[model samples]
Target: MKACDVCGKKSIIQKSGAHRYGGGWAMRATKKRKVWEPNLHSVKVTHDGVRKTMRLCTKCLRRVKAEMAKKVAKKVEKPAKGLHFCFNKSIQFF
Candidate 1:
């Protein structure tokens, strides 16, 4: 019943069987059905000056984290306009 709120990812059924090995030969047993669920986490998010909680999968969570990091990087102050710094030389303004 758990799923990602962002992407709507859900669980799936996987068919699997047991294998027996003997004398370099392999034998298969009766196939079984298994439920494969996505890795989901409950996260708290803030949007439009409001706080909310959401469920997100691992992939979506990673993407959100990367986007937040980019926002933080953009907020950081950079060198003044027309000013440049060189690794081998001193600072210069153009």
Candidate 2:
């Protein structure tokens, strides 16, 4: 049983309809059944300061990556306290 850790996505059975043609003007419709599997991949994920490997579907993986990127971007946009400087000599010390 293959399933996604993030979204609980699993394999499912699907049916498709097709038309069968016989002698002239005679036709019949039939249902074809097939198994559909989720696009799952093994990925390393960090949660609550612990890193672990998990099986995540593509959609969940994309969401996780986007969230990580947003967090990194927010950190990068902030100015470091040590890098701050003042022009005035007396004020620079405070």
Candidate 3:
């Protein structure tokens, strides 16, 4: 079986946890209220005699866990010059 290139661990089970939508929508509108997310953890797994460990980020290790990381990254990096999106426009919400 192929092993992890970076961690040298075997195939890992991609563990994921809850990620509230728009920070539960309250944070999006009020910007003061804070929604909570749990710590996401990736654990090693051995199934049917196969062994592996899923690679995870530091956020999963400590910070608020989220199921969607890449999508968040993209949204956070949206350029100010990009297409102006009206509030009513159907945005591709992560």
Backbone collision tally, model 2: 0
Q: How many clashes does the backbone of model 3 have?
A: 5
Model 2 poorest ten-residue lDDT run: 20-29
Global lDDT of model 2: 0.82
TM-score of 1: 0.66
lDDT per prediction? 0.88, 0.82, 0.48
30-69: candidate 3 lDDT, tens digit per residue: 3333333333346664548998776544444332235346
Residue 25 alpha-carbon offset, candidate 1, angstroms:
16
TM-score of 3: 0.20
lDDT value for candidate 1? 0.88
- Cα RMSD (angstroms) for every candidate in the order listed: 5.9, 5.7, 22.7
Clash pairs (backbone) in predicted model 3: 10-52, 11-52, 11-53, 12-53, 12-54
Descending-lDDT candidate ranking: 1, 2, 3
TM-score (all chains, Cα) for each model: 0.66, 0.64, 0.20
lDDT of each residue in 1-94, candidate 1, tens digit only: 9889999999999887756563333345667899999999999999899999999999999999999999999999876799788997898878
Each model's total of backbone clashes: 0, 0, 5
**Model 2 misplaced regions, further than 4 Å:** 15-19, 22-33, 78-94
* Residue 65 lDDT (model 1): 99
Pairwise lDDT winner, candidates 1 and 3: 1
Q: What is the full ranking by TM-score, best candidate first?
A: 1, 2, 3
